[model samples]
Target: MHSRIGLFLSPVHETGQDPHLAVRRNLDLVEHADRLNFDEAWFGEHHTLGWGLVGAPETMIAAASQRTGQIKLAHGVVPLSGHHPFHVASRAVHLDHLSRGRYILGVGPGVPFDAKMFGLAPDVQRRRLDEALPTVLELVNGDSRITQKTDWYELQDAKLQLPRFNPHGIEVAMATSGTSSSSPRLVGKYGLSMTSFALPFALMTPGAPDHIGLAQQWKYAEESADEHGRTLRREDWRIALPVHVAETRAEAFADVREGYDRWLFEYFGKAAGREVISPDTPRERALEARVEAGGALVGSVEDVVQGIRRMQEATGGFGSLLVYVADWTSYEKTNRSLELLARYVSPQITGSAARPQEAVDWAVASRAAGR
Candidate 1:
């Protein structure tokens, strides 16, 4: 029942803001996470999306590595379809060394906007992801003189110039989405971990009897691993959710209402050609829709703890819960929320072993007091 707490930053900021400030703010948050003893922080990569301003997660990872210690730095996901495998392998290996073995190489197909930016169609992007992943794996695993050619890229005797700092080698994770995904199978085939994104919420809605459960994602990974004669560990699974905690539900709702609405209705709805809900919508009604969409986790600390518990049950279990970073009412409130999460939520979820004894003592004390 104990799950490690981490942060997942798409580095989503309002368009037109200074991109330099956005990165500085994100790095500050990463430093904060390290001080709070957060297990990891994943930085996202996007090219065309104005909201996701980080074009290269490795660069940010390298900078953040110098600012903090102990916490692991993840690529969040680098789109393999757009980059040369040799480049990806070399940069990942170099970053692993820079972080001193605290780096995770997460791969995924490029997003639609990024694909278009690179003059690739969706189908081509997926094919590139499938074909290029294994080659990157081989190069990072110390393969030399690799002579492989794909429709997208070619390698002739390609190999990493630097050895991995970790003896076990840099950890590799593939990003997957929806209830079922080919990414899980691919991750399993390579004996790598899986990071669930846009999942546990991809198509969720209120009172919808059936939605993609977190357990289903794990199931696909397990099945794929079984087929490949490899055993996938549940602890290797990481799930991301947008969570906001405060002193009260009302305060939490108020803190997130503006930013959440802008993200849901304005950015996503308009971008996807969906109808946008009115900004003047009632908070309660907005809350319902947000819950349905699996966007914000707005509540008090106890509520967030219970929400995570429900997710754990739904997933059967997972190794980590990564909080998705987005704009809040103010930067100060955002930092406070992270502080409360680490101070309050982390202990509750990770300290389950001592709960039984504490509960027994409380009951016994109540009986003795004749309450």
Candidate 2:
């Protein structure tokens, strides 16, 4: 099956950038992706951080649906641990209606730091995820009255007053990063489409083959599926990672240099506590460390194509590639990076680039034959 090309906008704007524009640019990029024929764009929700400030992904998706023609829009994730399951279900179905079936619901156990501000214990999130998903899914699937009680939330015969836009039901994807997720069994129990984010240490170790446990993720899901007598389709499985491409490797690397340092210090360092390369390090050395991390696809368009191919094999194949939006480059250049992917990388991966090149080759061959 042909793979989808989508964007995952955690919407990582740096400290100095205007919050309004950061959010606006995310929509603009969605519009741009729509115009470019990209498959989908997923938005993140976060209230605590100065960066990634699009607090309500449903709102972003609703706004984006108006600007876009057909590109699929999704909540990159709604933090299940932090909100009532009914609220999640209602908003999800609402967005599904607003997008005319273009919306997908991706849910997770909430980011660790974001959970901190809500005063939710780290372990509570894991438990809440397992508890909340069933209720949320039940509500979204149809107006089935549910009665359930958990330490975090309670629902008594609750159902959606508003009917779901799609009778078939909304697509709910489970966002799992590394082993942080405690609900793979539940994931398979429900047969939710799996959306895997790049693990923080994915490429940190040399010779760390096996796609950062991509295959393992599916293995656990399939095992749990058998236990529940249901099959989770790999066609819905998605892997997301960082990407930035330009006309050349040098240009691509250069494009991300300025804001890259700040994003490291501010977002990754302060916010995430996962900064691999410090801004305090010597400039050249800091850059060298980044190049060594091997996490991002900061190279020519062709490089991205090849890198994704390797990832595809390592993951054993996936339905879509959602480019994790890290705005560590100029807005114009970031837009260009995506354009290059649409124009070059996509066709190359699908083997369509060769046909176009072959047509040109045929024209050149005739000229060489003195036609």
Candidate 3:
């Protein structure tokens, strides 16, 4: 099968933009992606950061599900560490039925800042995830009611009222941090899919863009699965990264200038406190570093294609490349990037389309020879 190309709408807004308008535009992006025949549209959940307007990812995803007919709608993540899994499963089932099985449930331990808002300690999130996830699985896919108790939550014969939309059950993906092995172990134990961390800076550490853990994550996942008498499939994995495509390298650079600046200056430099990109550093130099590291994609179609290839190599092999959504440029430019990815990046990046090259050559030769 061809690579699955998807959009992960974190829904970053321009400074001083209205939340209502930002949300509308983000939902509009889902429709645009659907029209382009993109494979999926995943929404993220974040409560902090003035710029991240997607407070409830499910709310937006539920709406997007109606607006989009073909593209799959996912949670990108529900931050299971802070939520009671029953509620998460219940809402997921609701969306599943509404979307008619087009829903994908993505769960994670969440970021430090957001978890802090919920009054959760950073180290305990993963432990809480470990306690809650198995019960969630039983509730979502199990035939009978489940009774489970933990320090953070207690489920007493809890069960979802709605029947699962897809008899096969909702497609589930566990989002992973580059440093954390909890996601892989949990996903492996349950035989579920995996979503690489959402952005370059946040993927590995607090705000570093090293992206040095894909191979290690999968290795740990397989080992965990083997320990559990299960197996992990490469096709069930997806890596999320920031991507913007344009006709030329310079144009692509220009398109992402504001977005990158905010990500580096406003988000990472000030709030995230990692100084991933120094204020004194040149914009082009920072962009080049991120691109060359396979952490972000901002360039021509070929450049984005190679970025994906670099990530694929890093992971050994995987299923999809989720374009972590951002509004670094105008709506027109952002939409154009998706169109370019669909029209050009989609076919060439996977090399699946390249398999038919010989046949095309024969047809061309036959036409030229008047045969």
Highest TM-score against the true fold, candidate: 3
Per-residue lDDT of model 1, residues 169-233, tens digit only: 88999888766568888877888988886423532254331224556767777888889999888
Global lDDT scores for all candidate models: 0.80, 0.79, 0.80
**Model 2 lDDT per residue over 15-92, tens place:** 875778777888888999898888889898887768878887888899999888779888879999998999999898
TM-score of each: 0.90, 0.89, 0.92
lDDT of 2: 0.79
What 10-residue stretch in candidate 1 is worst by lDDT?
Answer: 202-211
Q: Per-residue lDDT of 1-371 in model 3, one digit per residue for the tens?
A: 33379988876675576778888998889899999888888888878777777878888988888888888899978888988889988998999988899999998888788988888897798788778888778788777888887887887878788899899998888988666676788888888898885465442233243445777788878988998998778988888888899999999998887678777667665766665754554655776666655667889998888777777776688888888876777889989999999888998866666768878998999999999
Candidate with more favorable, higher TM-score: 1 or 3: 3
Q: In candidate 1, how many Å is residue 278 off?
A: 13
